[model samples]
Target: MNKILIVDDEPNICNGCKLILIEEGYDVDTAMNGSEALEKLFEQNYDLVLLDIRLPDISGIDILKQINEKRLDCFVIIMTGHGTVENAVDAMKNGAFDYITKPFDDKEIIKATAKALENRTLARENKMLKKQLYDRFSFDNIVGENHQIKEIFDKIQRVAALDSTVLLDGESGTGKELFANAIHAHSKRAGNRFLAMDCNTFSPALMENELFGHVKGAFTGADKTRPGIFEIASEGTLFLDEIANMDMNIQSKLLRVLENGEFKAIGSGKVQKTRARIIVATNMDLKKRVAEKKFRQDLFYRLNVFPIYIPPLRARKDDIPKLAYHFLKRFSRETGKQISGFSDDALEMMVNFEWPGNVRQLKNVVERLVIMSDTHQLSRGFLSDHLEIKRKGGVPDIQTPKTLDELKAAKKKFLTVYFGKIEAAFLSQAISRADGNITLAAKNAGMQRSNFSAMMKKHGIVADKSSD
Candidate 1:
């Protein structure tokens, strides 16, 4: 139910307005003066206030200023008996939502109040929709049914409710920012604004001003007072990406803000307080940098309260199939394509390959395939030829397999084709790299010693024992 506050000095006008609003199904309250209205405002929340211009003690403009200074979201509809076109315009400039002339009709009052309430409702709904959309494409959007990916999703949800600063450690293209945004969207301040800043994109001066705001005439472009992300995002979340790239001075400033919730505007004497949640993400080795004294220890501690480490794609190969299909559906709809999905061979190749650029690289490759490939289903040739991803590693001089089938056949038919010849070559290389240690040679191939012996025997390859 919406609450409306009506403030007026005249008894007849105030009572008439109150009766009309109550009959229209509003919870109405009447204040005879500015002091009484202020008291009522402090007592309970109001959706809209019908403020009188000719108050007994306070001016209507002063009331508007007080509401704005308090940063309340209630809409104010000005009621003026000294009604001039100038008065209406001035009321609007002072943050009044709208103005209704005194001795107004019942229809005008009802229509004006309804419109103001509708605008407030729409503004709130828009904010909610943005928050929902942001959370929908968040860390959970990584899209993998594998245990490893599911674990990461669970971690994101678990840490989101806390006020601790999160350090998302992941390789490049691992969707670190997505995780940070997810955390922010799920936090208690989800209704507030979420601001993101890329540390790599700003210089120290611009970054400090952008984070902490500046007073007018603080620097060259100080024509007007400007609020920074921290001020704007107060009671919300601030996501800082590529945090390692930030300058040392800015790092200390960020540390101070996180520690004390206080920062001074550029060239300003006043210190401002922020209650924004900080979520920092980086791909660099902060520990190594800290040991080198290039990164500040205090800032590192403030950011690392809850660290989320994401492994590379190579370590989570089981998730490739799910990720591939997710990206496939996304790009197919985006590009107006009827692509079916990846073929069996394509999935196998993806599982065997190392994704150096991680999830980001995979998403790009899927987009490329969706746009360029003529077939409904993705093929191994498209992945291998277009993406240039190697399914298996070897020397640079090694010849490419004739086809993906040949590569697959190489795995299943290692006995007949490359048995004697390839076994000897592999054994010789392994022995040379391992300095004639059989145990080390076996370990390098991720094979048991017995399995290595069996392979050597099946291929009729001989390795000479070392002479003491």
Candidate 2:
């Protein structure tokens, strides 16, 4: 049940409001003056407070100030006999939810109470959601026990407390965003917004507008004034992914913001200041980009204040089983599957195979395995045919020969005929799975299209015309 407090000097008004609110299923309390109201508020939390502007001992506006000073999370409605527009405006500016006159109707009072309680509930729910988000991205939630990962964790603990510009350098699919979120969650600004933008996803003009915003008459299609990421993320954190792909002109503007803490809207003359902490990520070598004159050297230096390098999945092979099982459990819960675990052979193959797509590719493969398997245990047979083929280095189901002579003869014979056949079959399956698209086939096989096609030609295989 919602709790409500009615504060008024008039005994009749206090009793009437208490009775009405109680009948409406609220636990209501009455305070005869501002002093009593403050005492009650400090004792317990209430969902809504009906405050009177005129009190014998103290003014209600002062009580409002006290509530704010104490950081009380309750809705306030001003009830006043002197219902001047100036008084109502002042009350609202001081955090009053609504203002009611002396001759207020009973229905109006009930309506205001209900609306205030509703808003209170919404605020509580938002707080809970933010807490959940913070917990989800906390450093402890990052799954890895490797030494390199532990070092990164320690670095995050030290870096998060400071308000420095962070540059994350890593390969594609190395989970740079995950590290970024962990940083923000552990930072002093965790309660504020964490906005992420991909530099490679937008064109130069659109990216500029997204970062710096625009005025009403800024461009042909701009209908009204809009705040950019910098404004929206004020006193928070802004994550820029693929930062090397940003245009050089925009890089200069971003550098200016970093240097002066101020920026102008696209078509506005007014300057605005922002206190957003910037964290940028890139897969490319930024130093190389600067040397080639593709990226601004000054801007790169500005962003590289505190650099963090995330190693790829191949480099962190020890974390493969942990990550694989982590993804398995997640996908199993999501898809309503009851997969127990992977077989020893399956786990070995996964650990041995090179994941060119890194952790992202491993996650995709795990999800696919979970969706396709019917048995509780994931075995080598359940693994992707390409991965199995890569592991065996030839066709699967080959039996070992009894003697060295037999082994040598079988190996030669297998090499003469089975090699070309198995290679062709593998290429055919990849292309067919990709709907005869060579580019996609090569990508799935973790090979360049030219290399995949050359192997295909060597095996006397040709792509279908429909593939074009």
Candidate 3:
């Protein structure tokens, strides 16, 4: 039950409020004066306090001041018989959550108490959500043991606590936003907002309004005022992904915010200031973009205060086994599969294949593998049939031949299986690049359209309906 305390010198007022609040399902306490109220407040934690401004022993403003000094989380509603605007303002200035006159009815008191307690509940829930977000993005969840990854970890450890701008460079699916979240969660402003924006996902005008917000009547269809990410994250962090893809017009405005914490909302003459820390990421070479005149050199310099590069999965093959097993364990529990681990040959196949889509691709593949598995261990042939991964200089396993006849038979089997995998992998890659356009894919591979379609049917690869 929500606890409430009523502080008033009038016995009738205190008793009436207590009875009304108790009927409303509250644990209500009464104090005849400010001193008794303070004693109760210090002795117990109350969700709401209903205080009268005029008390016989002490002033209610003094109690509010003490509450502020001690940094109590309870809400306060001021009550005064003197119904003057000045008294209400005074109460509010001293941190009163609400103000009411002394002649208020039972309905008024109940409403005030309910509203204050509602806010108290919301505050507790907000704190819990922030804790959950911090836990989700904590550095412990980022799995990697390679030396290159360790170096990045050291760099993050050094810079995560700083307010400098961060630039993350990596291919897609390398978890740039994860690094951004880690930085924000470790900073002094962790308790405040942390918002993310993708420059590539928004057009110039929309991006402007989204980053700087707009005032009411600033543009057509902009009926009411909206606060942008910059204003919302003023005391927190704003992460910008695909920073290199931002248009030049928007880049200039962003540069202004970086140079000075000032920006004007769209359609408004008023300038707004934001103290939000900036973190940007890109897959392209930023310096090259600057040289090509596609990106602003000044903005590039401002964003490069701290740079962290995440290597692709192919470059960190040494960590593939650990990553694979990690995904296996997670997917096993999620899919309720009895599969325990991978066969040695299966692990070798995954390690040898190039994962074009990086960790995300590997994760998706493992999820599917666990879902499809019927045995305790994953085998190389099973994985190969599902993955269609073909790499150069790798042949099907064959034992030493007992005689010439056996050798010929082994070569025939090896060539047929190995070359067939290559053909299937080729067709799959072509169709994917062509967006399922079989004719275009066949042309790209320098083959006839009918031949490509036949091969796709033979391999059970579905093709989308696209015009030649």
lDDT of 1: 0.79
* Model 1 collision count: 0
The list of candidate 2 runs beyond 4 A from truth reads 7-10, 20-25, 31-45, 49-119, 223-226, 384-468
Residue 185 deviation, candidate 1, in Å? 1.7
lDDT of 2 by residue, 1-468 (tens): 999999999999999999888999999999999889999999999889999988999898999999989999899999977646577679899899898888777899999899988888888886776687679987667888889989998889999989999999887677889999889888888878999998866778989899989999898988999999999999999999888878889999999999988998899999999999999998778999899898999999999999999988889899999999999999999999999999999999898877755777788788888888899999986784434244255554547889999899778756745675677789889977874456678999999978997886554354431110
TM-score of 3: 0.68
Which candidate leads in TM-score? Answer: 2
- Kindly report which residue pairs in candidate 3 clash with one another: none
Better candidate number, 2 or 3, judged by lDDT: 2
User: Model 2 — TM-score against the truth?
Assistant: 0.69
Which residue runs does candidate 3 get wrong by more than 4 Å? 7-10, 31-45, 51-73, 78-108, 145-163, 186-195, 201-236, 261-276, 314-322, 344-356, 384-468
By lDDT, who's the top model here? 2
Model 2: pairs clashing at backbone N, Cα or C within 3 Å: none
C-alpha lDDT values of all predictions? 0.79, 0.84, 0.84
User: Could you estimate the TM-score for every candidate?
Assistant: 0.61, 0.69, 0.68
Q: Count the backbone clashes (under 3 Å) in each candidate.
A: 0, 0, 0
Backbone clash total, candidate 2: 0
Q: In angstroms, how far off is 207's CA in candidate 1?
A: 1.8
